[model samples]
Target: MKTASFPSLRVEPKLRQDTESVLYDNESLSQFIESAVRQQVELRKANTEFLARGLASRDNARQTGQYVEAVDVLEKLQNRLDQHKAKHTTK
Candidate 1:
């Protein structure tokens, strides 16, 4: 696949030095920056999805007036966790 290049970033010298210091063996500064950009892109996408789901749930609740109480939800979740743990545990 043909790759396109993004514009270069001009960061402070000290910040650049600190970032370069943490790279693993044989890793380049450009590689580190690219990995960081990729991670931020993934995180932002996840965050946006989370917000959209919450908004949709809110709208559905408003339209239908049906909702689970927080305490009931927490209790159900805790019970499921305990069941899962029991199944996974040895002994």
Candidate 2:
């Protein structure tokens, strides 16, 4: 893989020491920071995909006229639970 250099950043001494403590003795700070950045980017990408899927589901529900108010949905669930309890309860 091709390599690139980053401009120096000024960080607090304690923070730098903390980061170095977690890295292997032979690992450069740049490598550790790069790996962390890649992981964060991947996490953000996954979050974006999840949000897109949720929005698509909402859109589909709207298009089908299947969307209900939160209160209505909660009430329906409560009704089902009450019916279930009534059926199982004796006397």
- Pick the TM-score winner: 1
Could you tell me which residue pairs clash in candidate 1?
Answer: none
| lDDT (C-alpha, whole model) for all candidates | 0.96, 0.94
Residue pairs clashing, model 2:
none
Each candidate structure's TM-score, on Cα atoms with residue i matched to residue i, is 0.80, 0.63
- Poorest 10 consecutive residues by lDDT, candidate 2: 3-12
lDDT score, candidate 2, position 64: 96
Local accuracy of candidate 2 as per-residue lDDT tens digits, 1-91 = 9988778889999999999999988899988999998999999999999999989989999899887799998999999999999999999
Where is model 1 poorest over a 10-residue stretch in terms of lDDT? Answer: 3-12
